[model samples]
Structures are given as structure tokens and as C-alpha cells.
Target: MNASYRGGPTVERILPNEEAHELLGLVTEIADGELAPRVADFETRGVFPRDLVRTLGRAGLLGLPYPEEYGGAAQPYEVYLQVLEILASRWLAVAEAVSVHTLSCYPVAAHGGDQVRKLLPDMIGGELLGAYCLSEPQGGSDAAALTTRATRDGEEYVVSGTKAWITHAGVADFYNIFCRTGEPGPRGISCLLADAGTPGIVPQQPERTMGLRSSPIAQIAFDDARVPVDRLVGAEGFGFRIAMSALDSGRLGIAACAVGLAQAALDYAVDYARQREQFGRPVIEFQGIGFLLADLATQVAAARALMLAAARLRDAGRPYSTEAAKAKLFATDTAMRVATEAVQVLGGAGYVADHPVERYFREAKVLQIVEGTNQIQRLVIARSLTR
Candidate 1:
């Protein structure tokens, strides 16, 4: 275990080993030197940081939890998530990109056939990027009702229908396509791994997002796109299960991102309050502002602890889906609240782009929506309790 201070309070981390400590230090260095400087420019221009993503992949930050034989670092889930937190503190888009790519690899790495498993090296190694295509325009939370259909053709499955809110749509080398294959309901779905360049696969224009503009999100139209039969992950009717399982881990990743974002906002607000004077004293010295900062700092710490608790359960091979949902729900909601208060602390400067809090405020919102909305997380936890 080691305690280190970044910009805000000292975070005491209980790492599994010395190697994990060194890995966090390395990630911090990369985040400061590589990610921080480019975030503003790339985000402002709505440019995807493809090369920066490649740099992370090359540095082994992209595949922290997969097996070493598959070119992954084989780190524990807890360590992998902390890496995401470190990256998100400097640049959230890149951290999210890493999380999505990791989620995209889960199907193949965990359930792919032998032939498709051969691609793990390239996918996990980050030589090839990937996308998870499970959400649809008509079916974001109701994943079982997804209308994307894949019919069996000679030696292939002809996929048709549109997937909405797909990250890395046009940029990924491969996509994990979850589609309907049988009768209506959860049992009808199947997963297919398809090459991004396959014919009839069209990526729509990127959405003009409020934040995380550096990471593109758009709908992908699969117009009778042909994917090999061998690309089917696990058995037919297993896609829904695979998708939910992946999201359990993905939610934890998002929780880590939220914690990092909130921590950054708190740190900035604290710094601003220390320097900005009001009534012949630093604003931070005032009881009104000091108590608010105290509450925000405590919330950030609690969120991090909750997220790490879920991750450790996962690393220990326990049932953590409900815990993951709880962490995601609490952390993201905390991020939205913390970021809003941070802006309030900054007054007028927070409303403008002059400070990073404005961006943080905007970015905090989508964390509550992605991976699974806060409402949906509540549903998951509720079901676990009753059942």
C-alpha cells in the first residue's frame, strides 16, 4: 500500500504488489506528459486522438486485465481500474476509449472459438482497435428488444439494421455486433465479430457532443453486411448474457472515470478558492466555501472506495454485478454533483471555457448515461435484492 498526493488530497491506495505501484507511477507520467497537453486542442477541434490511443496501447495501458499470453499485462481488475482513474484525471476521453476497447474485447477473449481467439494478440495488443455494438436507437436499456437482425446465409451471417451511439464507429478495426438471431426476447440474440471494412457497413457522421468530442459517437448502419460463421461468439442465443456480463466490468470502469473526474474538479476548485480573495481573505478560508469543499472531497473519496470494492470482488471471482451497478450509480451521481458545485465555487469563471471546470461539468453528465444509465443501474440492484 502507498499514499500519494496528486493535485487534491493524498489518496491512499492498497495495491496488490510493488509492480502495481510502479505501473501507476508510469501511467501518471504518461498522463501528464502525453494526455494533458493534447486534451484541450483535440477536444476543441472535435478531433479523435487516434495516435494518442496507439501510444497508450503500445505502452500496455490498453490491455491491463487480459492474459499475458494474449499480449495483456495480466494485472488485477483493481489495478486496471486505478489506471483508468489516473488517465481520466488528465483526459477522460482517452480513458473512456480504453474502457470501451476493453469491453469490446471481452466476448472474443472470454468466449470466442479457437479460430477467432487467434486474433486476441492483435486486439489486446492494440494493433487493432475494437467497438462494442449492443445499444440501438430503439433499444438502449431494453437490449433484449434490439432490432438489428442477422440471418444465416451460406457460410456467413447477413447482418442488417442500425446500431446507435456506437463509439469508435468509423475508426475501429473490428466490431462486436449483437443482433437478433431467433425469436423475440433475450434468447433470440447472438454476437458476431466483424471486420470494420466489411461491405455494407456504414458509419454515420459523428454527433456534435457537449463533451468528449475527441471520441466520436455515431450510428453504424449494417446493410446486409456479411460476417463469417466462424465469427459467432459462443453459441447462438448467448449474446444477451455476454453483453450483460461485459457491462458489469464496463460499469466499474465508468465508476473509476467518474471518481477521477470528480477528484479533478475538487482539486481545481480548491486551488481557485485558495487564490481568489473576497472580503480581505482567501475564499477557501471562509466557512461557507470551506465546508462545501470538505463535503466534495469526502464524496470523491467515498466514490473511489466504492468503485475499488467492486473491482476487488471481481478480481476475487465473486458475484459483483449488483455491486458494480451500485458503484456506477453512486460514483456517477457524485460526479455530477461534485462538478456542479465546483462550477458554483468558481463563480463566473466556471461558466466559461477559461477553466477546465466548465468542461468537467459537461463531461460529468454523460457518465450517468453511458455503460448503463443511473436509472437502469437502480433496476439492476432492485432485481438483485428481490430475487
Candidate 2:
């Protein structure tokens, strides 16, 4: 089913198509039955759910937006967006982890040589998982300043340095590690695939983040790591551009997830307001409570519109990187705001662990930081305008 906006009727209520309905059902069932039940426990423990990810892979949820030739469901980005939205409504961390996995696989699917292309059937096939590594200790927002080095040695390249804030760092089967192989700065960067368990590629302890605890962000250290020349994602010196391009689309995924999380928060808050009585009546009956609901509804709707607009531009093959940056920046910020406001609406219960809004509040913060920070998004937009 297709929905006009976030506040509008759901796809099931508006225009439920067979494909959308089926995908939604699977995501909702899995999220509700598996993720929803265990998410709090996992989050509190700050543990990664490796088996759950593989289960999604087996269910074909991991490759929903890729091409059928490569064992994907061949769904459009629009449908995939809805699937992500549904998942995020239940658990933002899980949805984002899946999104990161998909994005990590993009370089190979889009730029790999014939031999590499043949691997897509298994990679995008969901049998294998991937991670994208670009951020480093010295370079986070300034990805161009990355110091991770790759020097050619015989048939392979010796890679060294570290990549920080890598999602799924330890559990991923492979990584699209961006390294400097030529001149300094962005032009020198090149993307290479390194197996997680390979020598010299060490995933250190997972970062104890403020939120998204289960996704497992970490620093990957590479000391004299050797990468096969054939593992290059694209031609030498194209890593930065390749990484940036993947992030363009990847940001949209974050936007969609943020919108989903915000939407869920709004939905829950509104329901809670209706049920929670105030001095004389239901809190939702009062103007103050109604105003809060109105504001949250507007924010969620606006964020969804922005996300879909960016997605449509991508689908049309337009230059959508700037638009994507805007979506990610604005939508994630809105999510954080909306989630916090939702807690306010919940009053004392909001402060307690009785509701998921507390979790939503925590999850929203990471969206602003990943795929590029909000500050970097502004730079991309500004550069696009001036260029």
C-alpha cells in the first residue's frame, strides 16, 4: 500500500498493494515477535544480536532493495523505505543496522569488476553481510583527511591505520574500507574489501554509545593489513567519491528510519495522551495536549515528505546527494526533537522505562551523527548550492 504522508492513513488503510503488504507483514511480524520482545533486554545489556541479523538475511529482509539478479527481492526504494519504516517503528537500532549492512554492500554491487560482480548473488543474496568503513579517529566529519594508508606490494596492498565508529564492525563478514592510496586528501582515497577476521584487521571493543547500544559501533585497527588488489571496490583514487556516493543514498536510509522512529513516538504519545486522564478529563482533550500532538504530527509528516522527495529524486536519477543530506539532517533532528517532546507529553511515565519513547529518545541521537554528521550535511548542501 502507498501512503500520501506520515499522518495520513497507513498503506494497509490507503492503498495496500500485494508487494507492500507482504513486505510490511514480514517486517512487522518479525519486529513484533522477535525484536520487540527482546530489544529492551538486548539494549540494556549493550549486546549485538548477530543471530537476529542472520535470521533477517534468511528471511530475505536484508536485500529488499537490491536487484533480483543478485538474490534480492528486486523491490523499489519506495517499498524498501516502507519496510525500513516499519522496522524502525519497533526498534530503531535494528533497522539502522540493517540499513548499514545494505549500504556497506553498495560499492561492490555498483562498481565491482566481473569477478566481484559474481559475488553479489551471495552478498546481496543475504548469505553474507558487509560494513562500510570511512570514519577514522583523525577524520570523522572531515572524511577527506583520512589517514588510513594502503600501499601496493606485489599482488596485494598493505593497509594500515584505523577506521572508527564502524557499525557492525566485529560481526560483518567484510568491510568496504576507504584508504589513502595516492595523493593526500579525498582524491587519494580508495575503497577495498577486507574480511573481518583477516590478519591485521582488528575490531576493538564496541563503543559504549549514548544510544543504539546493540548495533555495535567500534574502531577497526589495521596494522600492516594486506588487501588483495582484486578486492578494490573501484579504480584507485576513487574511494572518497565512491564512499560519498554510497552515503548519499545511505543518508536517505537514515532519514527514513528517523521518520519511522519519530512517527512511532508520535503515535504512542498521542495514544497515551488519550488514555491518561488529567484533572477533569483525558489529556488529549485539552488544548495544551492537543497542541503537542499537532506539533508532533506536523514534524513527522514534514520529515517523511522530505525523505520521500529525496527518494523520488534518487529514483529519477537526478543529482540527489544534496537533497539526501538535507533529508538526513532535518529528519534526524526532527526525530530527536519529536522523541524528546513525546517524553514530555508522557509526564512521569515518560521519564520511567514504562514506555518505548525513552528508547526512541536514545535511538534518535545516533541518526544525527552517522552517515555524516548534521554539520557535514550542511556543508554538502552549501557546496551544492555554490557549485
Candidate 3:
């Protein structure tokens, strides 16, 4: 069974410049040579690829959209998302890790005080892995109803609560902890940057996820963890706005990941179909398999286009939350559909680990659930329309 499937239609992208094109070429080279070879083994063992993430960081892939003064590449959002798409084509877990880490840096980068901005160098450089702690077990979608509390205790804030479904939970060097500081609503929330090694900040065991096993997801319990007042990311009562802003960009990242995953599935299924034979001819020559592959290819292309359009909007510094929602909703749904049909195209072969389609199938399902559920994305878009 070939674990790496690199064959696919060459996408023609209208990049902003030669530098962006070269950057993408570098990413493609790394994806094929590094990520493709190791994904299967890492995923099977359920081991986190911290070293590979470091490698990506060293190569400047981790902070593409951030300012170069903070050790980032200062690439546009459009270019950054393309890098994510390329990475995700080879390995979804790694791409998602990059996305989450980028998101983790948002609160400080966008709204941090002058004191907190000093940490951007390490965080953006990937020397310090970061996690965003927003969704509590009971407040995944209803973020405004969060129960976590942070009280001002002289020079420190005593944080006490559990953050759920946090990627890079135990392994991260720092976390962006969102907790209530005043009244019970979005207005009361505040963001705090806490060291993962802080006493009383305990990480629970990693969840046995259905896919993306190479990435860790767990609950982090803050048992009165004392974060210094200086660690506050933004002004008090501003965490909810910071979180929503970060999520808009995060949704674009997930949408790009979905496009890559779907492309990989379609490519694999097409390759198998071309070689697979029945009735004295290739199976792809038959209308049933041929049409399915055609539709899948078209859908993947459309999803990529939608995702890129949203990224371009962000690049233009326009309001793109609704567009990001639409892209995340469509691209992930397309990935699920494409991966499922890829399995069907391969018949019995896809059901087993002998082919990568099985892994792609499992991986695609989680994209619909993560960042925000497709249903939640619909709600965001619908509200945008009515509002």
C-alpha cells in the first residue's frame, strides 16, 4: 500500500508575486519529502510530531501571516493559507497544528499591551508552541455562557476552570486562557497568557480521537493558577472579541485544510480508478466511476476557490467572517463527501489500511466538526444575512 499519493491536477494560482510562488514551491518540496513519508507511521502510533512542527517553524512556515519584525515571514493571508493547503495535502494533523498555533498567537498580536507584545518573537518563531483555550466542555458553541473565572488578586489573576478540546494541550509551552472576570456574558471575558508549566495548570490525558491522532487534544485544568497581571493579552472584558476575531482567520485555515484533504482523496481515487480494471477495460472508463470522479474533482476545485476568495478578502483587510463561515461550511462538507466517495470508488480496498483512502475518510469527518461545526457555520452565515 502506497502511503503517499502525490498525483493530482496542477492548480494554477494567481499569486501576488514571485516570492510567493517560490515560497509555495519550497513548501511543496517539504511536504512531499518530509511530511508524506512520516504521516502514516506517526498517525499509527498516535504520536505527536513535535519535531516536524519544529522543522516547519525553523523553515518559517509557522508564522507566514505575522509581522517579520516578530520573526514571521510577513506573508499575506492568501499565501499563508496556500501553504496550509499544501501541508494539509500531505498531512492534516500537521496543518491543523500550524493553524491552531497561529490562532494561539492572535490575541497578543492583535490586542496585547506593549508588555505582552514582547512574547511575539518566541511565539511566532515557533520556539514556544501555543494553544488557545476558549471552548469549555459545556461552552463549546455557546462561548458567551462559559463558566471559567479569573479573579484579580493583587498582582496576579487567580484562574480556575477547565478548557476542553485544546489542541497541543500538554505539549504547548503557553496558552491563551479565556475566562470570565466580571459579569456573566461576553463582556466579562478576559484573555490571559499562561505558561503551560505554571503550578496548578494541569493537563489531563489526551483524548482518543477518531483521527488526527498525531495531534493531541485534551482538557487543561486551571486550579487557581496564578497568572501575573502583566500576562493579560488585552484590556479586561475584551477576550470574547479577541476570540471571535481569531476564529474568523482560523475558519479560513480549516477551509484550506479541507480543500487539500479533498484534493488528496480525489487524486488517490482517480489514480486507483485508472489502474483498476473490469470488463476488459479500466474502471475509470465506465460512466459510473468516471462521473463520480469528475464531480468530486469539480467540487474540490470549487471548495478551494471559495477558501481562497475568503483569504483574499482577509488579505484586503475586509470584513470576512461571514465569507470564512461559508468557506468552512462548504469546503469541509465537500471533503467529507469526496472522501466517502473515494472509499466507494476503491470498493473493498479503501476499507482497509492498504490504501490511504481509509485514513482520508476518517480525517475528513473531523474537519466538519472542528474549528466550528458546519451547522454552526450555517448559523453564522444565516445571521449575517438577516442582520
Model 2 per-residue lDDT tens digits across residues 1-387: 001012323533222368767778778778777777777778888888888888888888888878888888877676777778877877777888789988988898788887677778777756677888999998888889999999999999999999999988888888889999999878899999877777999999998888888888899999999988888888999898898889998999999899888888888888788888979899999998898789878878888888888887877778888889999999999999999998899887787666778878888988898899999999889998887
* TM-score top scorer: 3
lDDT at residue 23 of model 2 (Cα atoms): 74
Compare candidates 2 and 3 on lDDT and give the better one: 3
lDDT of 3 by residue, 1-89 (tens): 37766646667889999999999999999998899998989999999999999999999988899998889898999999989989998
Q: In candidate 1, what are the lDDT values of residues 39-97, reduced to their tens digit? A: 87888889999999998999998889999999999999999999999899888899999
| TM-score pick, better of 2 and 3 | 3
For residue 267, model 2's alpha carbon misses the true position, in angstroms, by 1.2
Q: What's the alpha carbon RMSD for model 2?
A: 3.7
- Please provide TM-scores, in order, for all candidate models, with all chains considered together: 0.98, 0.94, 0.99
Off by over 4 Å in 2: 1-17
> What value does the lDDT take at residue 252 in candidate 3?
94
Alpha-carbon deviation at 66 in model 1, angstroms: 0.3
Q: Lowest lDDT 10-mer window, candidate 3?
A: 1-10
